[model samples]
Target chain A: MNEIMSILSYTFFQRALLCGIAISFSAALIGVILTLKNYSMIGHGLGEVGFAAIALALALNLPTYAVSIPIVIIAAIAIMIISQKKGEGADLIIALVASGALALGVIITAFTSGFGTDAYNYMFGSILTIGSADVILSIALTVISVGTYAFFYNRLFLVTFDESYAKARGIRVTLYQFLIALITALVVVIGMRMMGTLLISSLIIFPAIIAKRHTNSFKGMVFTSVFVSIACFIIGMFSAYFLNLPTGAGIVLIYMILSALSLATTKLLKL
Target chain B: MSLLEIKKLNVSYSNHYALEDIDLKIDEGEYVCLVGENGSGKSTLVKTIVGLKKQDSGTINLNIELGKVSYLAQFNLKDLNFPATAKEIIMTGTQKHGKLPFYSKKDKEVYKRVIEQLHIEDLQNRRIGDLSGGQKQRVLIARALISEPELLILDEPTAGLDYNITQEFYKILKQLNKENKLTIIMATHDIEELANDKPRIVYLSKKVVYDGNYDGWKGYEK
Candidate 1:
């Protein structure tokens, strides 16, 4: 207990906790929509695109987010366009793009000097290095994401469930789809700093699936996903601090365990 | 003026014509049934009317604005697993009213009225996935009616329903058309059962083979 308190006393740990919680909340909300649409893999694909952008930024000694955000957004739009075409599934397009981005990132890292350590930290995550600026950015992005969701909740729900019906109702299905993709891309870019490129998609997928096992309504699933994600982040952060484990992997493990518990409980209760 | 008008409309898939040179007109408060075999362009015509598909070369003139058309797509159980209550699903129909984040009192009243009208009050709070097929169809119809649309377009709504449920579903549609004077355009393959409703039939086999009452359709089919 004393050791946990001592870890919390550090400013970096405080920032990490705040950032993780905020990002998790936003990711889970986006995850519910994406997962229900069967576009969950887009999160992972965008993370890889962000990873590539981050590597390019590192090679150029530029700001990480400033470079990654715009590129990831473009990649997201490209994915949307490619997926919109007939005879091609979005998952297949996302897989192609994700593999391409991962390869590009690896190639960039191989050439960039002194990037090995930063790359390793980015991939595995080091919450100990989280700064105040990252916390502020995470909070700001979270507000944008959550606020956008709240404001357009009805439209998003309509588009996600039955886009054809939404279109006939004059809901501008394409515009809302683009908006979701943009928001998800931003969330992926911000999340990569704390959760790492390889593991960030877990933050966007696990909570929603876990909540889905227990809830029978969209609102219930969304609310429960946010709650579970925030709780998991907090507990996972504490465990990472006390157990001297990697933050991203530790949090993902916690989510896996909770997901298993949720699955079993739901089946047992027949909910 | 006709509530809906389609002239010289052509739709194709990979250069194979699905609907060719289709010309049709529907006036207000008309309960029109479009009947055809599979791949006979019944679905395509309705889809084009609702703006789901684009016409290759023609014009579709709707007297009412596009927003006033409510559509219930063909029943696909893929989205039945979506986590939404019947009430929530119905409430989304009010999205066309304004830009408010929440439904207005009038919107809520409409929702309530539709729920009552559809006799789905008991199922309002129930999850859509939990409802029986007939019950889900009622909820979807309620969703369509909540918008107070001038025209309601449904595509094979009773495709999977049993005979009793299908009859009940058609009865509700007939009531809406007669009592409320709601315009309806439905596409279905069950011409024999639907013929009893006395709806004006538009028979199509890639093109309109008959456009008249059921007796005329029977004569034309023979």
Candidate 2:
């Protein structure tokens, strides 16, 4: 407890906690919405786009956040357009886009060679990388995520449950679809820095799945996912600090354990 | 005044016409049953009326400016695994037009009226996945009706139900149409079943093959 309190007293550790919680909360909300639509791969795909955007920003000597955000948004909209076809076409488009963006990032990184930090740091995530600015951005994203969700909760529900019904009711299905894609892109870009592009999507996927195992209602799923995400992030950070594990790895480990436990609990409760 | 009118409408997918030069007009408080074989565009016509798909060329004038529509899509069209209580699902229908954060008091009252009308008040809090197939359909109908739509459109609402249940379902629709003066448009391929119900049947095979009296339409079918 004394050691842990010392870690919390550090400004860097505090920043990581603030950033992680905010990103995880938004990621979980976005995850539940996308998972309902069977578009979970969207998070992974957006992460790849985010990586490429950041690499490009580094190459151009521009601000990473400004450059990465717009590029990811554009890519997200493109994915939305391609995914409008749905089924095999949608899956193929996401796969193609994800692979292409990842390849582009790798190629860009090789040419620039000016990224000051090790690419390994971005790949696996290092809590030491989060700055005060990142903390602010993450908090802003949380506010945006919560506000967007609160205002559009019904429309999002209607769209996710029965899109045709939403369309027939005169709701702007395409607009809301774009809004979902846009917000998801924002979450992916911010999350990629802390959780790594390779693993950030897990932050979106795990919480929602874990929450689903524990609850049977959509609202319950959303709240549970948010709770699971924040709690896991905090515990994982602490575990990583104490046990000498990677932060993302520790968080994911905790998520995996809870997932298995929830599955078992659901079965035992039913029995 | 007719609640809906479609003139010279043509819709195509991949160079094949789903609906070709379609002409349709539905009136206030009238019940319309659209019948066609599979791929004959019964679903296409309903989709166009509800504005899901835009017409390639021609016009659809939905008469109601407010034009509130309650749509119960086919069973296969809805994602039943969606984790929402029956009440939450129903309440979302009323929240689309600027009612935000949560359902309002007026929304709650509308919900009460719909559930009382549908008599599925008990299923309100039950998870969607837990409801029986017939019960799911009832909840969907309640969701649609809670909006107090000027027109109610359904595509194969009776699919996957037993014969007795289908009849009972239609009986409720009939009562709503007769008593509440609600406009209804339903599309089904169940020729033998719905033809006996004697609603105005518009038979379509990519176009209006027959319109008006089902009695005369039977001769036309022969």
Candidate 3:
């Protein structure tokens, strides 16, 4: 308890904790919709795209998340449109874009001298470096995410549940699709800054899936996922502080442990 | 009164046309059984009527309010396991009434009335996957009927049901058509089974091949 308090005495630690909770909430919320819609990999897919966006931002000496958000959001919506046209082979489209973007980022990294080390920071993340700017952005994100969700919650439920039926009722299915993709892109970009491109998708994938095992309804799953995500983030941050571990890796490890335990409990109890 | 009129409608995908030069008209309180074979355009026609798919080149004239046309899509194998409950699913039907969440007094009334009307108050909280085939169909039908639509469009609604359940479902549709005076356009591959219901058949195979009552459809061929 003393150690955690000491860690919190530092402003950087305070920023990291605050930012992490905000990101986790939005990540889990978007995660439920993505997982239910079978778009889980879109997180990882956007992560790879974010990598290329970061590289481009670095090349132009611009702000990373700022540049990454628009590029990733566009890619997210484009992927959705292509998937709609291509039908159920969305996995293939996501794989194609992700691989292509990762390759492009890698090429840029190879060409830029003395930049590989900085890129490495983004790959694994350095959450201890969280600044006031990041904290402010995260808080803003939380407000936007919650507001967007509240405004469109019913329409989103209809689109996610029965898109064709929703469309037939004169609901704008395409517009909702765009809104989900847009929010997903925002969360992925912001999360990548704190958790890195490689591990951020896990934040979006694990909480909803874990919550799914425990909850029965969509609303239940959403609330449970947010709870699980925030809990995991705080615990994982504490462990990282105490054990001298990387925050991203520690959080993901905690997620894995929770997932295994959930599987085991469900199997044994037959619940 | 004509509820829907499709004039020279044509819908096509990449390689070939799914529906072509289709012309049809539906009147109020009519029960239309759209029968077709595999790869035929029964699903396509219904989707077009509901405006889910844009016609390549044609006109679709809907005399009724757009919200008055409810579409109950074919039951998906994947969606059966989805996490929505019967009550929640039924509430989604209220989406056409407005986009915001159900906060109005009238919205609650519609929801309560639909469940009571369907006699599905018992299945309200049950997961959709837990319901029997007939019960699932019942819930889906309730969803479509919740908006008090003037016309209901169902795509292969009885695809996976047992014979008895299918008969019971047809009886329900018959009741809706006769009592509520609701117009219906149900797409199905089970022509032989539907023959017993004796609805006005519009046999479609990329185009309208036949449009007549069961008596006139006695010896119709592809």
RMSD of each: 1.7, 2.1, 2.2
Over A61-114, each residue of candidate 2 has an lDDT whose tens digit, in order, gives 889889989999999889888767664565678899999999998899989974
Best by TM-score: 1
lDDT of 1 by residue, A12-67 (tens): 88889899988998899899988998888998899889888989999999999889
lDDT of 3 by residue, A1-271 (tens): 7877788898888889899999999998889899988898999989999998898888778888778989999999999999987685677888999999999888877776335656876777777657888888888888877876788887888788877777778787888888889888988887776787888889999999899887657778889999999999999988877787778888998999999998899899985
Model 2 regions more than 4 Å off: A86-89, A114-116, B77-80, B95-99, B219-222
TM-score of each: 0.96, 0.94, 0.94
By descending TM-score, how would the candidates be arranged? 1, 2, 3
Predicted candidate 3 versus true structure: per-residue lDDT over B1-222, tens digit per residue: 578888999999879999989999999988898887888888888888887777889998999888788888667647555777888888777734444554567767877887787789999888888889898888998888877889898899888788999888888888888889999999987667766668899988898999999768877753
Worst 10 residues of 3 chain A by lDDT: A109-118
Indicate which candidate wins on DockQ.
2
Best by lDDT: 1
Quality class of the docking in candidate 3, CAPRI style: medium
Interface RMSD of candidate 2, in Å, is 1.9
Report the C-alpha displacement of residue B188, candidate 1, in angstroms.
1.3
**What tier of docking accuracy does candidate 1 attain?**
medium
